[model samples]
Each structure stands twice: as C-alpha cells, then as structure tokens.
Target: MARYIFVTGGVVSSLGKGLSSASLGYLLKSRGYKVKIRKLDPYLNIDPGTMNPFEHGEVFVTDDGAETDLDLGHYERFIDINLTSLDNVTTGKIYSQILEKERSGKYLGNTVQVIPHVTNQIKDFIKAKTSGYDFIICEIGGTVGDIESLPFLEAIRQFSNDIGKDKSLFVHLTLVPYLKSSEEIKTKPTQHSVKELRSLGIQPDIIVCRSEITLPKGQRKKISLFCNVNIENVIQTVDVKTIYEAPISFYKEKFDYQVLKHFNIKNKKQPNLKPWYRTKNIILNSKKEVNIFVVGKYVDLKDAYKSIDEALIHGGLANSIKVNLNKIDSEKLKKNQIKNKLKNADGILIPGGFGKRGTEGKIQCIKFARENKIPFFGICFGMQLSLIEFARNVLKLRNANSTELNKNCIPVIGLIEEWYKDGMLKKGDLKKLGGTMRLGSYECNLNEKSMVKKIYKSKKIYERHRHRYEVNIAYKNKFESKGLIFSGLSNNNKLTEIIELNSHPWFVGVQFHPEFKSRPLSPHPLFASFIKAAKNKK
Candidate 1:
C-alpha cells in the first residue's frame, strides 16, 4: 500500500526533474519514511548500454549490472542507495518483453494493442516493484506533450484511478521563462503545460517551477489559479551553486511539507540538513584552487565523465580547495600539438574510454605526465595506455601495442580471457564485440608497503570495473624491474588492479572506476590524494 508520487516535466526538457525527485526522496526519508525512486524512460532503446555517450550522456551501471540513465547516478549519490536493473524501465524494454510473450504464444492468439497489452505491462511493472515502500517517487522521462510519452502518461493516469486518488499524487515541473528585454517572468508556458496535463486526465498536486529568479507573489497566485494547485504548493526552484545544496534549499522552501500534506502523512522530527549545507559552504568558501586536465574522447558531453568530474570535485572538498577541470580532447593531442594546453594544468588525468581512436594521443599524454613528473592518474584504458607508453619508452619495445588494436601483437596487452566466477566459466570469445571482459565490483589485495595501500589505508579493497583488455602479466616482472610498482592484484593473483611509479612523486593507474562510488560528503581516497598531490605541485 505504498503511496505514489508521479513526477513529470513540461514546457521543455532538462528542467531538473531528476534532481527534484531525488531531493524530494531525501526529504521524505528524513521525515522517517521509507522511500525509493524509479525512472521511466520513454526512449525506444532497451537500455543506454549501446548508445553513444555523445548522444545519451553517461551510462550508469548499477550493482545488479543495469546500464541505466545518468540520472540514476544522481539518485545513488544523493540517497546512498544501490540501485538495480529493475529500478529503471524504457518503452523499448517493455515492448520487447511483451513481444517476446506474444511470440511464445503466451497471449493465446489475441491481437496486441497499446492500450490493454502495453499499458497493462507498464502498470504491472509499477504495481509489482513498488508494493512495499512507503513512498515510491517515479519520474517520467521527456516532456508532457511528447508523442512517445503518451502511453506512459496514460498508464499512470489509469493507475491513479485504480489505486484511488488519495493514494497517488502528481508533481509537475515546468519552466518559467524570464525575458531579459521585458525583465519579467512569464507564466504562460506553465499555464499551457498544465492545460496539456489536464487534457491527459492527470492533475498535478504540486507545481515545481524552474526559473532564474524567485517568482513574485502575484505570479505565484496567478499560476496557482490557472494550474488548479494551492499557491503554497507552487514551489519556486532557482539555480543553486551546487547540486548537493538542493535538499536544504528545497526544504527551506517547504517542499517536504507540501508533499506530506498532499499525501496526508504526519510529520515526524525536523530534518537535519546541516551536512548538505556545510558541503555547499565548503565549496563556495574555498580559498585554494588547482586545475586538473581530464583527457578523454568524450569531452563534448559532460555526462560521459559524470562520476570522474564529481570525484575530482570531492577531492577538492577533502582538501578545502577548488578543482578547476580542463576538459582536453585526447584526439587533439595525436598531432603532438597539445603542449600549450598542458602547460597550466597542475595535474593530468586520462579517464576510461572505448575503441582505438585517439588512443595514441592518450599514450602521448601519459608519456608527457610521466616525463614531466606531473601528478597523473589513469583509469581502465588509460591504465593500459600508461603501460603501453612505459613499454615503448623504457622497455625499448619499439612497436608496443595492445591486442585490442593489433590482435597479433607480440607480448600482447590484450588476450582471449576467461574468468572463474564462483567456479563457473561464463564463456565468450575475445573476438566478439558485446558484453565481454570483467565487469562489476571485484576485490583487490593491495601490497602492504605500496602508495595505494597507504593512500587507501587498507590491505583489501573492492572497486567497480568495466573494461575488455588488461595488461599482460608476463611483462609484470620486467615492468617492475623498470620501477613500475604492481601495487594491487586480484585475489587470484592473475589480474592487476593497480600500478604506480616508485620514482615519481604521484603517479598511479587503476583498472576500476573509483569515481562511480565518490560522494560530496565522502570523496574517494584516490582522488583526494591526487588533488593533494596536485596542490603540492603548485
């Protein structure tokens, strides 16, 4: 008997519905209610796994291995909850399941239609998964008027009736544009957006308005009158300095009070949001700043490097400093013309990516970092490139290459691999393209005297990984002899988890995605240490 809060956006997309939903969930949780957030994407793609980062932003992977929308990343960071594949759904996945059932003759030769069949599947999904929680805050992707979202809207509308109106509430987020020439905020867009929702048989209980400035009392009353919501329930959301400040800001605006009143839940103890407020103050009042260059192929889209960016920010927070990130295109460095771009950066970081394009540039950047004794951190493919650079320069392997690029490469960095997971062989040929190599979290045993162990202050640690190729272990001793310390290894002693340079001030590479687990309150240790080292370089 969980109460449902359906969140939808109008006027336009990117209205911060995801953040708003997460903030609401946080507020509700603080009031002593069990809360869970779910996302319903209207896209036809089964998941974001195969989509390009430029097209769709970052594909967030869950503990249960669901490649989900980047908003799930925000959800996890805000709530400290580990989401699973079941937490997100798209039109493509819903229809694919229905079609499979049809193909198997499970429908008994009935003609399939969007209404009873598709909508039924959607409703079933909602009802089945959301049964036990106190509040299930579901955010619908896309705007209200989009054609792809019509069925989802219909399903939610019907679900409200089925569950009774008292148990369900709709929160519509809309943009209130301010015309600079007129110097006045317009409410016409929100008025029309509400009209659209009303046409679809859904009435919003709360209206979260996004604007550059606070709405005047007159404008708020006008919107309340037109949209059929109380003036008190019409909340204004202005731009904040940091995303972490959202909960505190919204709470001050009485967002949780409105939600509880709408759902008829008694308020418990007052929320203690001092931690979020303190984090924002620390970021805003920092006296020191350090610039770090993140070299990657997906520089055009910030979401592709979402976790990495946040982790670096967290690092800055740990040191009470500001981290100014310079997004450097790895492809541009292929011509050896990026010296000017690298000049002012206190540290250089090469993040993970796929394919062979721009890899040589990444290797070149690694060489530059190593030669200059700059603080450097490499991840996944970045780690592989570091080894390749070391092999070419120090090992004197003239044509050092990865097996991913040159399949027949001598002393290949990539090899056809098999992993023993719980004594079972998940067989897949190395030649195949999709879903190979090590994925998800695995344990790594850190060398006791290594820099990584000292930084983490632990002998055993686990981190999430997403990569296809690994460094050839046969070259381990040779590379170690050349001063590359094998700082971390898998429990079985076969896979390398971390590597560092003993002679350099701060240089490390990890095969896992540490950024995925970083938070504003709890920065990842590696990033915190890296930023500290970068500050020292300054």
Candidate 2:
C-alpha cells in the first residue's frame, strides 16, 4: 500500500508546486523508498499536443508519447525517473474516456454525472497506477478555487477519505505577498485560500509558502494558525539563484522532514546529495561564462524552450562556466534581422519546432553558422533545416526543401513517412497526420572519427526523437559527396543523424530530442561540447 501526498496551489499560480513535489520525491528516493510522481491537469485539452507553444509553452512528450504538461519535465529532471504516458492526466482526457465508454454503451445508461462518474474515474486513475510504489506524490494543476479544477479537487477529497486519512496527505502551496506600500508581508490571501480549500472538504496538512523574503517566526506562526496547519509544516520556499539548488535548499529548510513527519515516515535515512551539491558549486562559483543564441519561434515565453534552456545551464555546469542565452526569433531572420541579434553570440543553436512558419529564417541562420564557422547545433527540425541549407547553397541544389513544406520537394530533406520498430515501413505510400511518426528513444550507431562519436565518446547511443520527416536516403550520396557527413545512422543504414565540416571548428545536428534526457547533475555531452566550442570561439 502506497502513501499518497496530494499537492495543491492557492492564492496564485507559479508557486513552484511542481518543484516542491519533485524535491520531496528526490528526498524520499534517497531514503531507499520507491516513489512515483503523478500530475493531474484540470485543462480541457485532451493532451497538450495541439496547444500552441507561445500560448501554453512547450508540450513535454513522455516516453510513451503522452503530450503532457511541462511540470512532468521537472519531475523527470529532479528525481531521475522516466515518466510514461500513464503518469499525466488532464480533465479533458478523463472526461473523454468516460464519455467514449458511455457512448459505447459500457455505462448501461447511468446518466453520467460528476460525482460517481467523473470523480470515480479520477480515483481509479490514482489507485490503478500506484500499486508498486511506496509513495505517490500527486500534484494538482491550477489553484484551489478554479472552477475547472473543482472535479479534480472533489475526487481527491473523496479519495483521501476512501483511502483512510493515515494513508493520504495534502500539501497546499500558497503565496505570501509583500506590500511595498505598507513595507510588510501580507497573510490574508493565504487565510482566504485555505478557507476556500476547507469548503471543499479538503484541509491541507502542510503549507508551502512562496515568498521573496524569508518568513519571520511570527509571520510563519500566524499563517499556521489561520491556515490550520502545524507551525513546523509552514515551509518557506524563497527564490534561489539556480533551480538546481532546490533539492539542497529544501533539505536545509527541512521540507522533506516536515513531509515525513506528517506521514509518520520514521527511521528513514537521509539522502546523499553530493551530486547536486557539486553541481551547485560548479554553476554558482564557476570562473567562466559563454553566450549562446537560441533561434526559435517561441521566444517570448521562456517555458517554450524550458528544457533546452536548462540543458544549456547544465552544459555550463559540466564545463565550469555560466551560459548566457540570447533568445532570437527565427521569423526575424527572414527579413535579414538575425545577424544583428547573433553578432555577439559565441555559439548558435536552433531547437525543434513544427510547420513552415519561420523555417526560412532558420535556414538562413544555419547558412550563417556554416559560413562564419560559428559553433552550431541543430536539433530535430533544426537538423533538417541544416541539411536543406547545405543542399541549396553549398551543393547548389536549386530545389532543396523539406517534404513537410512541399510534399514534392526536389532535394527532399524532410519526407512524410513512418518507419517501424523492426525496420519495416508503415503507411506505405499514404500520408496521415495523427500519430504517424517515429517517436521515443531509438538506437543510432555513431561512426568512428566523427564529431558526434568524439563528443559522445561512444560508438552507439540512444536518444529520444519526435518527428515525422527524415533525410531522404535517395539524396544521401549527393549530400555526402558535398562535405555533409551522415556520421550517425540507424542499423538499417538509414540516415538518422548528420554532422558537418569535420575540419571546421564545431558543427553537429541530430534528429533527436537530446534535451529530453539532459539533467542538471548530468549534462548531455553534445550540449557540453557545443558550449565548450562556444567558449573556445571567445
């Protein structure tokens, strides 16, 4: 039987509930307890796949192809756990499943309602997935009073009662705003937030207060008294310099201790946080710094490039330097404005994206990087653009383009198709949009004496991929003859990856999402090498 901790946010959004949950999971895992974390989103979207990166940020893809909320990425990085599609659930997904069953006559005309139908579905999701783990940390998306999140809250309240109070606990994350006019910290919002939560039959056992300044003893006691939680359970979560410091910082504040004490988790040994501590030292006290420009469409919202941004930071930790990222809109390059934005950059990176919106700009950036000998890295769609740029300018192929944009692209760098697990072809000679692509981790054999091989220090590597079109094999020979190297390939001799200008300073690209696997304590070798190359350019 696993003990459950349901985390909720109140007073406001952006309260670091996801980080808090992840940090607690790390502490529990360090104590030799098996743990799993789950995220319940209250949004109506069945998945984040169709959501705009600019509107909702990056849609994190799980190993099993679940387009999930970005918080799941936090869970994976902090706890070193591989999350699956089963780990994340949205209200839209739950209701859709139930409605699908109802339409199929599986409901037997029960006149589906929220109480036993929707709420029961949520409870079932929790109970079915939590069988093996000793502790299940579940974070509910949105604040307590959100109308969209009511069903989820009601389900959790009933779940706690059904599982017995001893087996479940609730942690409320609320804001402690500082009033500049009064020169004082306010606690009224938290009181009201708690009161709202209590109205729904859910009382938080612990309160994680988000504040810019440390909450004084008097303030902490007052919050505890009004919020109806213990004084020790009122954990203060102040902002830190680097998010990697979260595990160590929370440990010092006894965030894990309070959690264990609430659930009576006795005799649990402390976690050995040597790796995190070392990473923090490398990031904060490093002697060097490098600037890298991230050329992409979703530059306004930082979360759109959340994983890529953090991966660069991790690379800085690996090389004992600070990474200063300059977000440049790729669309600006179509008008020849990218050069001004990238003039001071030590390196240039083009991350993955969809459609042909700003692709011309991306191709122009790739051309500039190749010509100027700038340290360059292209990921997924970015990799395809690099090949297209090389084909059109260097090889002088007049009709080079990605099949994604034009199905009849002459020197097709991207083709609409699906390759199977056993080297078989699927949707042969047919084009379908929904779920027709190579997704998840796949092995690629790296050629010896190649840039990728040298960076990885391994002949074979597996990386996560999420794209449909690949470099057309028919054009492989022509591209290779023109100095473009197909240095990494699948076992079937399919060109799954590429690198360029071996004699040049630094240039590489891959058709995989390496950012998905990078961790603060363990930076990806490619990013580390790219940053190192950038530093050398300085």
Candidate 3:
C-alpha cells in the first residue's frame, strides 16, 4: 500500500505547490523508494486543451494523449517520470464521468449527489492504478476556499479518515508576506488559511511557507503555535535563483526529513543530490553563452511556453553553456525587421502554437534563419510553417499556407484526416474543439543518413504530439526536389515527421514535441544537439 501526501495551497495561487510536490517526490525517489506524483485540478474544464494560453498557460500532453495542466510538465521534469492520463484529474472530467454513469444507470436511479457520488469518484481516481508505488504525492490545483475546490477538499477530508491517519498526510503551502515599509513579516494570512483548511476538517500536518527571506526562529515558532503544527514541521522555502535548486534547498531545510519522520519510516540515509548541485553550479558558472530567439505568439507570457523555455535551459545544462532566451513576439515582427532583430541570435527556435495570429512573422523568422545558415529548430506548428516557407521560397509556390489559417492556398499544411492511436483509427472531427487532435506519443522512423538520425543515433523513436495539421504529403517530391529532405516519417511511411534542408548548416523541423521529454539530468538528444550546434555558431 502506498502512503498518501496531499499538497494544497492557501491565501493565493501560484505558490509552487507543483514544485513542492515534485521536490518531495524526487527526494523520496533518491532514497530508493518508488514514487508517483499526480495533479488534481479544480478547474471545470475537462482538460486544458481548449483553454487559452494566457488563461491556463501551456497544455502539457502526456504519453497517453491527455492534455493536462502545465504543472505536469514540472512534475515530469523534476521526477524524470512519464505520467499517463490517469495521473491527471479535473472537476469537469469527474462530473462528466459521474453524469455518464448516471445516464447509463450505473447508480440504479439513485439520486446523484456530491457527497458519495462525486467524492467517491474522486477517491477512486486517486487510488486507482496505484498499487506498485511506495508513495503517491497528489497536488491539489487552485487555492483553498474556492467554491470549485470544495468537493475536492471534502473528498480528501474523507479520504484521510478512510485510509487511517498514519498513511495519509497534508502539506499546506502559504505565503509569508514581507512588508518592507514596516520591515515585518506577517503570519496572519497563513493563520487564516490554516483556519479555512481546518474549517473544512483538514488539519495540515505540515505548513510550507513561501517567503522572500528566511523565516526567523521566532516567526517559525509563531506560525507553529498559531497553525497548530510542530515548529520543526513549519518548513520555509525562500525564492531561489533557479528552480532546479528547489529539492536541494528543501533538503537543506530538512523538509524531507520531517516528512519521513511523520510517516515514522526509519531511513537515515541522505539523498544523492550531486546531480542537482552540479546542474546549479553549471547554471551559475557557465562562461559561454548562446542567444536563442523564441519567436512565438505567446511571448508576452513566459508561462505560455513553459516546457520549451525549460527544455532550452536543460539543453544549456547538458553543454555547460548559458542560454539567453530572447522571446520575440511574432505579431509585432515585420518582414524588414527580421534581419536586424535576429542579427545577434546564435540560434533561432519557433515553438508550437495554434491559430494564425502571428504566423507570417514566424515564417519571416524561419526564412531568415534558413538563409543566414543559423541553427534552426522547429516543433509541431513550427514545422508546418517551415514547410510553408520552403514551399513559397524554394518551390516557387507564390501562395503557401496552412489550411487551418486559410481555406484556399497551396495547402502546404492541412488537417490530418486520420491516424492510428492505440491501434484505433481515430478520425478528426471538425465540429469538436476539445480532445480532437492527433495526440500523444507515436513512433517515427529516421532516415539513416539524416542529421536528426545522427543526433539521435537511432532508427526509431517515439515522441509526444498535440496538433491537428500536418505537412501535406502530396508535396513531398516537390519539396525534396528543392533540397528540403523529408528526413523522418511515421511508422506507416504515410505521414511526414521531420524535415531538414540538405544544403543548410543546421536546419531541422520536427512534427513531434521533443521538449516534452527533456530533463535536467538527461537532456533530450535533439535539444542537446541543437544547443551544441548553437554554441558552434558562436
């Protein structure tokens, strides 16, 4: 049986509950215990697939085609685990399942209520498929006291009671605001947050305080006394220069020690943190720097491309180089400004996004990178745009664009009508906007002589994807005649997966998202190779 640790936030959102859960999972894993981390989102949306980037950040795609919260990316990167659709649950998903069950008469015409039906479903979701792990760390999304999170709170409250107190724990994260004017740290919000949690019948076993400065022993003791937690269990997590330092920082504060003590497990061996220390040192002491421009529609909000941003950093970590990312807003870019704006960029990256918001500008950026011999890497939508750029400039197709943006064009990129997922032939639906894409992981076979093959050193690889359109295979020969190599194809040899310019220095576009698999300790091969090429460009 796996022990449970429910992580909840208080006072405000974005307090790094996901990071805290991931850090703890990493610590336990280092201690040679099997662990898994899950995110229980309170949003009513079935998934984040249809949500706007500004509204919900990136929609992370798991291997099993679940478009989940971006925090799953944090969890995967920190713990180095590949999660599944079962790992993420949302209110919308829960309610929809229950309504389906009721419609199917699974409840036998009983009144479908929140207490047993909803709470039981939530509990079943948590405990399902969790037999082999030693610990299951679940991070509850949204802050406490929100009406949407009420049932989830109640479910967890009941969950603790049913599972016995010895096997369940709650960790509450709250902000410890530092008022510079008064030069005093306030603990009332944390106290009130705990009070709110206790009102819901969930007394937190530990309180993780997020503060700008270290909490003095006096404040720690005060928080312990007011929140009714042990003084030693009141852990402080000060802001660090890099998020990679989180596990190490938490370990320094004995956060993991307190957690183990609560479980009454007697393991005195310390976690092996040399990899984290080395990564931190490299981040702080790298001498060589490469400026990579991330041209995208969501440049205004860095979180919109959270995984890509972190993957580039992971690339730099693998090469002992400092990556300076220049986020360029594609909407504001003009054709004439491309050269001057990217003159100093050693490499250029275009991340995946939907709609035709700033696509013309992205095409211009790709053209500049290709013509100037700069290291260029493209992903998903980026790959489609690269195909369009090649079709227009090289093949003399005057009007080339994706069918998603324009109905009448060269159709360099168009909707993939059908694809195989889990051995089922899934068809694309024009009416649905949610969960209707060629998603999850798929296999691609690499051409033996391709640059990507050299980088990966493998003939076959599986990468995660979240897209509706693909490069039109009807134009493959035309593209190849113009020196654009379709270097990779799907297992059936029907879909184009990767493309490269035979004459260019380092230009590669992939239809699948390699950024999803990049980690700090072991960077994805494509990212590591891209960073190496970018460094050589300097």
Candidate 4:
C-alpha cells in the first residue's frame, strides 16, 4: 500500500505549504523512495487555466495538459518529476465528476450528499493518483477554518482512518507570529489552529511553524505539549534569503527524519543535497550582475510571473551572474519613456499573457530591441506580438495583428482552429476558455545553422506549451524571404515553434514556455543564452 501524507495550512494562507510538501518529498526521494506530490485545491475553478495570473500565480502546465496550481511548479522543481493531470484535483473537477455521474444515473437515483458520496469521490481521486509511488504528499489549498475547504478537510479526516494510521500522516503548517513589543514567538495562533483542525476530527501529526525567527527550545516544547505532537516534529522554517535553503534548514532540524520515524520507515540511504549547496553558493556569491527589464501587463503582482522570474535567476546561476529583474508595467509605459525605463538594461524580456491589454507597448519595446540590437526574448503571447511587429514594420503588412486581437486585419498570428495533434490534423473548437487550448509538451525540430539549434546544440527538442493560437505557417516562406527566420518548427512542420532575426544581436521568441523546465542547478538553455547575451551587452 502507498503511504499518504496530507498537508494542510492554518491561521493564514501563503505559508509555503506547497514548499513544505515538496521539501518533504525531496527528502524522501533522496533517501531512495519513489514519491509524487498532488495538489487538492478547494476553489470552484475546474482548473486554473482561465484564472487571472494576477490573482493566482502562473498556471503550471503538466505534461498531460492539466492547468494546475502554481504550487505544482514548486513540486516539480523540488522533486525533479514531471507531474501529470492526475496529480491535481480541485473542488470544481470533483463536483463536475459527481454531477456527471448523477446525471448519468450512475448513482442509481441516490441523493448525492457531502457525506459518503462527495467524500468517497475525493478519496478515490486521491487514491487514483497514488499507484506506483511509495509516498504521495497531498497539499490542501486554503486555510483549515475556511468554509469552502470543509469538504476536503472532512475527506482527509476520514481518509486517514480508511488507509490506517501507520500508512498516513497529516502535516499542519501555521504561522508562529512574533510579538515584537514583548519579543516572544507566541504559540497561541498555532494552538487554536490545531484546535480548529481537531474539531474537524483530524489531528496533525506534525506542526511546521513558519516565522521570522527560529523557535526557542522552550517554545518548541510548549507547542508540542499543546498540540499533542512530539517535540521533534515541531519544525522551524524561518525566513531565508533563498528558498533553495529551505530543505537544508529543515534537515538541520531533522524534519524529514521525524517524518521517517513517524511512518516507521528506516531509510536505507542518506540524503544527497550537494546540488543545493552549489545552488546556495552561486546564488549568494555571484559577483557579476546583469540587469534585465521585464515589460509585462501584470507588474503590480510579482507572483503573476513567478516562474519566469525564477527562471531568470536560475539562468543567472548558470552563467555565474546575479540577475536583477526590473518589472515595468507595459500598459503604463509611454513611448518616449521606453528608453528611460530600459536604459543600460542588458536585455529585455516579454512574458506570456492573454488579451490585447498591452500589445501596443510591447510592440514599441520589440521595435526598440530590433532596431537598436538589444537582446530580446519573447515568450508565448510575446512571440505572437513579435511576428506582428515584424510584419507591420519590416515586411510592410501595414495592418498586422493577431486574429485573437483583430480578426479582420492582417493576421500574421492567427487562431489554431485546426491544427495537427499527435501527427493528425483535427478540427478544433475552443469556444470555452478553460482546458481547450493546445497544452502540455510537444516536439519541435530545429533548423540547421539556426540560432536556436546553436543554443540547444541539438536537432530536436520537446518543450511545454499553453497557447490557443499559433503563428501562421502559411506565410512561412514569405516571412523567411524577408529575413524573419523560422528557426524552429513542429515535428510535422505544421506550426512554427521558434522565430529569430538573422541581423539582430539575440532576438528570439518561442511558442513554448521554457520557464517551466528551468532549474536552479541547470537553467534552460534558452534562458542561459538570453542571459549570456544580456551580460555580454552589459
């Protein structure tokens, strides 16, 4: 039987529950156990595909096209595993399944209630994803006392009994707020939070206290006594300069060892955290720094582009340079101030987003980069707009625009209503916004003597994508004749995957999201090249 560890948060949200679960999985996996992490979101959205990035960070795309919570990104980065759609479940998805079953009379006219019906479905959803893994760490979204999370909370409570105590564990993460005036880390909030969780008929096996200062010995013992957990299981995760230090910090506190002891699993091998040591050293001691300006629509919320921001940092680590990202609001940027905001910047990057909210400013910046030979990297929507800019300015298309933005104009970038998928051309219908896009990983073949081929140093690559429209392959020949090189194409050569300017310094745009695959120890090649170009420009 597969062991389960359900992680829940209390007192507040954004307490790094995802990171805690991922770190636990990392530790267990390093000790020679096959592990996978799942996210149980209580939100009503079937998936985060259509959600605003400003509200919910980046929608992490699994290899199987599941638009999961951004926490799944943390899980993938820490565990080094490519998760699938089965790993992410939401209230909307669960209710949709239940309602579908009821409508189909699969329930046999039974009144669908939250007790056995909903909870059983939740249990099955959790169990269905746990086959072939020794450990399954499930992170519950939102806080413990929220009403929306009641169903999931109840399900996990009953799930522990169904699976037996020895095969299950509940890890609770809560805040231990410091009273600055009194200069003490009060444990009352954590106590009450655990009390609330217990009221729901679930007791936490471990309490991870998130605070600014490390917990004192007396406070740990006090928390253990109050929460009815072993003192050693009360792990301290104070604020750190880098999140890569989290596992090492918890290892020093023997957090994973306590988890092993609770599950009665004797580790056959010790953990190998040497890679993290290198990450820490490079992140802290990189003497040379490069400035990269990120012009995007959602500048107010940094989480809106969390993965992109982290990828740049990873790229910096790969090149032994510290990357300083200056986030500029594209919608608010004036044409005259483009140089002012981007002056002395080594490179400029435009990340992906939906709608036509800030296309004009993006085009202006792209024009600046192309005309002045500044290093530029454009992502999904970024890639689309780059083509539009080239068509209007260089190719003289005059009224160039995407069908997604203007359907009646020159459509250099058009919707992918009918495209090849798995080597077959299929008619597409994406009237709804949710899970209808061409998502997940796809194969791309690089052209010989192309910039991307030189960077990747390979003839073919597989990258993850999450876009509804694609560049018009019909104009591939004409565009290439005009010096706008189609550097990368799909496996079937039906879609353009990458574009580059032969005459510019380092101008490239990609249809896939390479940020999802970037790592701290080994950044994505495109990002490393982009940063290298930016550093050289400096």
User: Which number leads on TM-score?
Assistant: 3
The digit string of per-residue lDDT tens for model 2 on 1-538 reads 7999999999988889999999999988988888999999999999887899988888787777667888898999989898988888999999999999999999898899999999999998877766789999999999999999999999999999998999999999999998888889999999999999999999999888888888999999999898888899898888888787888888888988877777787845888899888888877887788989999999989899999998898888888888988888887565457677678889999999999888988888888888899999999998888888888897788688876787555645544353321323443533442246667777799888788888899999988777877777666777778777889998777555666666569888888888888888678898888889998999
For residues 75-173, write the lDDT of model 3, one tens digit per residue. 999998999999999999999999999999999989999999999999999999999999999899999999999999999999999999999999999
Residue 498 CA displacement from its true place in model 2, Å? 3.7
Please provide, for model 1 over 43-80, each residue's C-alpha lDDT reduced to its tens digit, 9 standing for 90 to 100.
99999888899988877877666788888888887776
Off by over 4 Å in 1: 334-336, 415-437
The predicted structure with the larger TM-score, 2 or 3, is: 3
Better of 1 and 4 by lDDT: 4
Q: Once superposed on the true structure, which residue ranges of model 2 sit more than 4 Å away at CA?
A: 334-336, 417-435
Ranking by lDDT: 3, 4, 1, 2
Candidate with more favorable, higher TM-score: 1 or 2: 2
Could you give me the TM-score of model 3 versus the true structure?
A: 0.96
Ten-residue stretch with the least lDDT total in model 1:
418-427
User: What C-alpha lDDT do the candidate models reach, one value each?
Assistant: 0.87, 0.85, 0.91, 0.88
Better of 2 and 4 by lDDT: 4
Candidate 1 displacement at residue 467 in angstroms: 2.1
Q: Can you write out model 4's per-residue Cα lDDT over 141-247, one digit (the tens) per residue?
A: 99999999999999998999988999999999999999999998899999999999999999999999999998999999999999999898899899889889877
Query: TM-scores of all models?
Result: 0.94, 0.94, 0.96, 0.95
